[model samples]
Target: MNILVAATSVAAVAFLLLSSNQNIPESVKPGSSAALFALGTAGFLVVSSVLALLRVKFSRWLMLAAALIFFGILGFQSLALLVSSGASLPAGATPKLWANVIRNTLEIAINAWALLSAKASTFFMGNRPNQSSEADGSAAAQL
Candidate 1:
């Protein structure tokens, strides 16, 4: 169980790296693409990490929302690929679409497992009410 959580954590980090290479419109500068990808991927990872660790309802909702977003992107890209004559998009569009589809698909699966699996939910939920309060009280006492 712990191994599973660790695995997902590693995946989150890998996602950071994978996202760095996402395709950007030519109109957007190269530097902006890096920054945008970093921010978006890192932000999602950080938030998702926290949400999963807490094992709150928000985490469940977040997983659902993220899946929807990824699915939407894939759907849009598939549409574009069908209709596009390679005129409007950059030459890299196909690779970019596949890259996104793969990463998003992986993330959606991992997140769903984190949210829905009882073992994962228990692992993330941690020691729950008692542990957090005790730690907080200890810190407060020290302060």
Candidate 2:
């Protein structure tokens, strides 16, 4: 599950990078890229969530972070689309390109964090069952 999430994150980032290039067709605009990235991110989130619900180790934070990041990007994209269609802002409207760029930046950051966290957790678990068990015991004791 961690591997799957990491792979999807990498693919999502690659898609976003490729779609950002001007050489790409206008049909593959930021919006389309965002949509595709969101799909991949959402898939990862769903899979991770299931794993977490099953009490899978190391997935809790990664899943929550991915979900937040994907939802944030989705929200930003929706707002940009609405604004582009002449939806009025109460005060001043954010520029569409800026909003898109911000969303992409945040999505990248969150994905990277999730990947790193998953990797760290895997490494930590792979070599240290005793440590994990002790930690779990302590946590349970505290509870």
Evaluate all candidate structures by whole-model CA lDDT and list the values in order.
Answer: 0.56, 0.61
**How many clashing pairs in candidate 1?**
0
- lDDT top scorer: 2
Per-model TM-score on C-alpha atoms: 0.44, 0.37
Residue 65's C-alpha lDDT in candidate 2?
73
CA deviation > 4 Å runs, candidate 2: 1-36, 87-143
Return the TM-score for candidate 1, rounded to 2 decimals. 0.44
lDDT of 2 by residue, 39-88 (tens): 67767777776665555677666666765666566566666666675646
Per residue, candidate 1 scores C-alpha lDDT tens digits across 1-143 of 32343346446545554464558444443354654653554455556556656665566566456444544554566656746756576777877776766665666677677667898666655655445454556674566
User: Model 2's lDDT to the true fold?
Assistant: 0.61
**Which candidate wins on TM-score?**
1
List ranges where model 1 is wrong by over 4 Å: 1-26, 29-45, 70-82, 86-93, 124-126, 129-143
RMSD of each: 8.7, 11.5
